[model samples]
Target: MMKIFGKVAAIVAGSALVATAAFAEDRKSYPAPKDHPLSEIISGYEFRTPETRALQDDDFENPAYILLDLGAELWSTADGAAGKSCASCHGDAAESMKGIGASFPKWSKERNKAITVEQQINICREEQMQADTWKWTKDPNMLGMTIFVKNQSRGMPIVLDNSPEMETVRKLGEEVYYTRYGQLDMSCANCHEDYYGNYIRADMLSQGQINGFPTYRLKWNGVGSTHRRFKGCMKNIRANPFKPQGEEFTALEAYMMYRAVGLPIETPSVRN
Candidate 1:
């Protein structure tokens, strides 16, 4: 598997090096909300090659489905001291989880802060299942379960909380998005907002939207969450990344979702 992955990586890197001289011109435009910063919104999907998009469109071809299937199994398999499964409480996820993913990073009244689906999964495991929490980016079970739940909301437009509390969170995220960080002194906006569609070494910078996470990236050779992507970008800029599931990332997730207001949920989306 490592050999295969290394070969794929080398080929992708080689192609990227060849394409470095050209700016991407394949971005699809969508009308932004009245109050949005940009006049248009673009999904990261548009930045990928047609082959990758085709993989995302075909359930059988998309490698992410392997993990999604695991999530489906985990949903029914009982676990922890309580001997309860997610299916035990939620019943049929098709019915119970529908549209839930599109409205996540929601204000948690009990926690008194915005919480992500990843965090909520751990909360359920600890409080209800009496099971240990899965590591944010390291656990395949967490990534699988997250994508499974999100897949239920595929094609639904993203709709986020607009309460004053959520508004504050969104504002903080926006601040983080625009703030320069690390040795390179680059901000998220420098690539995603300003140079989107332009080549950055071997990759085209997209809008950096989070609507399609936990996405399947060819570079990772597997599925991963939005926070994983966050950590990667931070490292690329030579900054110390905040911990996954921490306040900063949660706030950023909330804000990015807000930016994706009308975009359809594309869970298990395939990306370069």
Candidate 2:
């Protein structure tokens, strides 16, 4: 992993040298909705090195496919008291799960709160499959299945819930995004919004988009969820991170998704 990251670091450093000349060319920004804060929205992919982008572009080359394959197998394998697999109820994922990834961090009327795709997966396990819920950040199966499910919706534009309840959640997320936290006294907007396209150490700041989540980050040497990245960012700021799948994170996800509106899903995206 160190060897791979070393190569990536070298490439990133080289890319940074010409970054000023290519800044506008490299960024792929879209016109934001009239109500959105920024005039344009940029995907995290824009900040990645060419090699990392190439990895995400090729399905076979993407390391995340290893976990995605496991998720596909698990989709058809029955378990728990019900002995029913995801395939049994959902039929083929390509058909049943299509366009589903873009509508995540949805409002749950039953729960009276917003829930992420990870939370929904656990809900299915406990309620539909009669199986124990997978650990949020610990279980490889959780991350694998998420990547698989979201990958089914690759290329679809994000379309989040806009109900009154969801609006409340989105507002909460907006608050979290702007609020300064930790010993560093920095908010998410400080880096992603204020310093985007600028090099911070060796890494280029992005718009903090979550559309490409369950992303395969080279820094991690593996695929990880948006929440995992969130915790890492909090740690970087010397802040106490929120627990995965918690209300705060769910709200934050909703806000990020809202920010990424109209951006195509790029699950299992490779990033450095």
Candidate 3:
């Protein structure tokens, strides 16, 4: 009887060990190559080939510059019932918008949320421009306004201060980054962290940072916003895409900016 009791106890212990091991394996099943090393991850700009880099170097050649010029016109031109152009309130784009891109998806007290430059543009449009806000796909003007604003902060490092009030928002964003979704049962980290530098067909994956947003994509043949890329990634993994400027995407943006804190802002960057 004593021998039989000892045998039963040993079997239970072995079962417990097996269960624990399984749990651990599940937790680490899809990890970044270096566990998402902050120091080692390079900017997408760095991942570019010399030919692509050269294209981005010339302001005249980069196609995204057209939007920059348009944005300047939109900035100064008056519209809407208020007849208040962005310039009427803000004075000058260079002076008023400098380093502005680096500071957003910063916490907005009035909105009680993280707001991106695009969202801010619309907000200003309704309030300041007294005009309609431009949607992402239909209008090139949105891209124009966005890249123009981002260009002011070019070369400046991304600055995201996760304040005490914003702790929950940032946490939510982090959860979104790691949480698995879609048919592939993968998260952003699975691609950006785990598969960085790996080829997904012809394209090599980078850390998936948005420091170079309002970026020109060869795939799109046009400049796209950070949220546009987010939706694309979700769709690629067979997940339902979020609204272009939705709250969840804003949270994700906040977290991504944190992930890429200290990285230089490189607007109108070229990507394949």
Off by over 4 Å in 1: 1-27
Please provide TM-scores, in order, for all candidate models, with all chains considered together: 0.89, 0.91, 0.84
Model 2, CA-based lDDT = 0.89
TM-score between candidate 3 and the true structure:
0.84
Model 2, range 1-272, lDDT digits (tens) per residue? Answer: 99999999999989877867677675888889987877788889988888989998999999999999999989998978899899989999999999889998888889988888899888988899999888887478999999999999999999978899999999999999999999999999999888888889988888889888898889889888999999999999999999888988889999999999999999989988
lDDT of 3 by residue, 189-239 (tens): 999988765668888777898888888888889888888899999999999
lDDT minimum window of 10 residues, candidate 1: 20-29
Model 1, position 16, has a per-residue lDDT of 90
What's the residue-level lDDT of 72 in candidate 1?
A: 96
Q: What is the lDDT of residue 70 in candidate 3?
A: 91
TM-score of 1: 0.89
Give per-residue CA lDDT, model 1, range 43-88, as digits (tens).
8898888898999999999999999999999999889999999999
Arranged by TM-score with the best first, the candidates are 2, 1, 3
At residue 245, candidate 2 shows an lDDT of 84
Q: List the residue pairs that clash in candidate 3.
A: 32-194
